[model samples]
Target chain A: MNALALGLRRARFETAVYFRQGDTVFFTFLFPVVMLTIFSVAFSSAGNFGTKPDGSGGITAAAFYLPGMIAAGILLSGVQNLAVDIAVERGDGTLKRLAGTPLPVLSYFVGKFLQVLATSALQIVLLLLVARIAFQVALPADASKWLTFVWVYLLGITTSAVLGIALSRVPRTGKSATAVIVPMVLVLQFISGVYLSFSQLPSWLQSFASVFPLKWLAQGMRSVFLPSTFETLEPGGSWDAAGTAAVLGVWLVVGVVAARLTFRWIRKDS
Target chain B: MSETEHVSVRDLRKTYGAFDAVDGISFDIGRGETFALLGPNGAGKSTTIEILEGYRDRTSGDVTVLGQDPGRAGRDWRGRIGMVLQSSGESGNVGVRELIAHFATFYPNPRDVDETIAAVGLTEKAGTRIRALSGGQRRRVDVALGVIGRPELLFLDEPTTGFDPEARHEFWSLIRLLKREGTTILLTTHYLDEAAQLGDRAGVVVGGRLVALGPVDEIGGQDSRIPVVRWVDAAGQREQRTTEPTALVAELHRSTGGEVRSLEVIRPSLEDVYLDLVAKHDSTATPTGVLA
Candidate 1:
């Protein structure tokens, strides 16, 4: 009847399909949990979690990796998943059929965005649970800290998702989608401090990491979970909440604009 | 826009770079009528259909579907029409009923999902995943979604392109059911028999022009085309093309003392006339800009 109702129906269908696909569920939701568990068990063997350096507590491996894995999970789902799906749909002629239908194109995007949000939300929660129970990782204290995590996570994932939607036009066929999307995601993951420590890298590397939102998003999450004393390990020796929001905010705006310009319902060769 | 006319096009033209895809064509489809636009590949059939479906912009033309210009039509107008594109619609291992029900919400008034599935002969496959189905079965899914909206008008672009004879017959019946329910249909196909079977009226589009448009049986000057009479003569066998086969047969009957062996008369089939028209147009090809 209404666009919202129809869009919601489509979204539920999309999410159901997402869950049914084994690989997608494994990569988007389960992989991070598995990684967090492995890292937590490996690093906490010394049994010094929340009781090192500072008399209060020290950062554990799970605490360090939970944020990075969360960030990576978000990136994988929002960027790789969304973009690859779009490209594959294009190759399969799904988009062309959609263009012919009475359904508004905006409704289709709304469905996909909803799917992204649901999967990403599920991922963050699972990572949080595993980190807390298995590794004794710290949770955000005070309302402001929790508030910071919420906005940063939401904005950062959404920005990546929007960029994914825009970049779907780059690949001509479903087979080509991975070729187009994987390299960029791999570059972002390596340079954004998702796999390695930002402070341990050279100054040029840190500067390079700061240019992207994944770095800030992971840093923002670390700020929430880690004690204030651990801020010295960050790029500017402290959490830059304002900078994180501004950079991600710019990416969201630019992504929306690019999606408007780049989105295509029919491929040229077709 | 006449009340009886569901679609009206005046000099519909579409251009791609320097070439005219849909050069200059004009045709009308009455309300509740099944009109088949038959053409070969690259005959601009798809381009014309796309413009009518509101999926593409035309270079220049006057066209209307359901009394609305498709180029400027909105969701309200779209709600009144259904489309079965050349490509598959459903995706990702979804069951038949689930996919149909999802599409139904996009329309204001929709047919019951079960009824729609049954109408397309997919009742047994309701719970079957789309990807697991055969090509023809998947095509039924396409037809299922197209008619699920209970659209006033339906556009089917090569709907039975890859169908086997049996599946095509089944699809034809489905279309007939829709026609009985008073849904206007505009389908494009390369199969002459398919056009003759399903189309009440047929339009032959060649080089993007409506060369011949009339009832399927009478298309391509059917009445005027001469019939050939063949019979066993004193000289073994003879055949003659004539406007008056009856007279020739009568003479032969009398001369042979009513022993007209192997005598038969046959008029040109639709395929013959269509081939003739296409060949004629192909040889005398002119720039599309010049209206024929």
Candidate 2:
């Protein structure tokens, strides 16, 4: 068979295998739903949670945390999935076997890219469904807002997935993969406005967050679901679609190059 | 380019850091021959094989497989060679038949998947997931995968290492069957008996060099050194090492004026010559500072 056909076949087989694993399916699809449920319930009553800015009124916690939940889904699909899967495949010598075949290195990455895209699409649909049905959140009414969400989410996921593949090359063993991913996940979540609004953070922290794709992604995502007036709270009183796209595009290029240069198909021990 | 030489290597060298894994070795395997590379662990057999397989780049060497330099050969060249690596960690979710069918697509011409499976004695387990197969049965699957392309040259690296005695015999028979089909086979094994049984000619590798290469029986070719004669003597038993076994036996018969009891002549086995050759190679190379 041609390389592209073989690559797609292998990639489909890999995706099927991932779905069969009970724990993977739970973590990839079910975990987000569970977290969204708990967060929605805890934040149901407007005045019961954290107070609003200026202490004049209490912001509805559900409104404040919905964006974080969506960002978390992106992280799960992009970073966590790619990192752990590549590391495990390397540990098991599957990559080594593929390296010897006629299948080129780019084909493997293409397969992974397609898998991540499909999974991310599924994650976004599920999150939107849960928000509308369970929490009574309003759906995007305008075509432009929905288009913004789709592009931002796709660019965000593609950047993170490629970064994860690049980063996974550093860990030689599967056990070390978890150790590397956990700390990175925690740090990125903190800086990305997943736990708090970037506008509420200190100026220095805001500037630092601006350097990463995560903060821009979360901001871009929030711009879609939140009111157009919320744009006033942004660094500029506008949605910097071009800026967000640039940051993600740069990261994508860097990630693809680094993965090509550093990735090792065979085990160091072997 | 000799007509007899099906495989050839000249000044093959591979280095990792400051160490020479394969330090300038050369050898040849004749057409329709089963050649065995015999060595201990860390003796550079694997390095040499990896270079030959084009899985690893060599530091410097002139090497050819099927008359093409593996390093620069295209897909068609690779299709002509089949390698059963020391370990293959392919996914186990697919049934054996499905897996073999998938690999068969890589070649321009492939053997019938079912017939190949049957040749490896895995017909009963064709539908079984590879993960569920026992170690021996899994090894048979590996063999089946390696030969699926009906390659002109097959490289079997420690192919029967984990096999039971019965399974090993079956594997040997399969290899012999391949030889009958005019496929040149190159194998590396730690098992001496396997080499003795399968190799038409065996080469002993030591300290990154080939110490001896010839037909299994004539490796050392020290036939005149002495044969050990053992038999029942006047008291109980006697043994003697002598260069002239026929004269000794004749003298013993004349002295006894009758048939010799329990007469037996023992010659050196391939294992004995192999160990001795490796030891001599080791001692000679050490003083000059050779490294494996």
Would you give the TM-score of chain B in model 2? 0.87
Model 2: CA > 4 A from native: A46-67, A264-270, B1-6, B91-95, B222-227, B231-264, B284-292
Model 1 spans with C-alpha error above 4 angstroms:
A41-57, A264-270, B223-225, B231-238, B244-264, B284-292
Q: What CA root-mean-square deviation does each model show from the true structure?
A: 4.0, 4.7
lDDT of 2 by residue, B145-229 (tens): 8899888889999999789998899899999999999889999998888999999898888878888888877886675235778
Residue B173 of model 2, lDDT score: 91
lDDT of 1 at A68: 79
lDDT (Cα, tens digit) per residue for candidate 1, span A223-254:
88777877877876778888889998998998
Clashing pairs in 1: none
Question: Cα lDDT of model 2 overall?
Answer: 0.77
Best by TM-score: 1
Clashing residue pairs found in predicted model 2: none
TM-score, chain A only, candidate 1, equals 0.91
Error of 2 at A47 (Å): 5.2
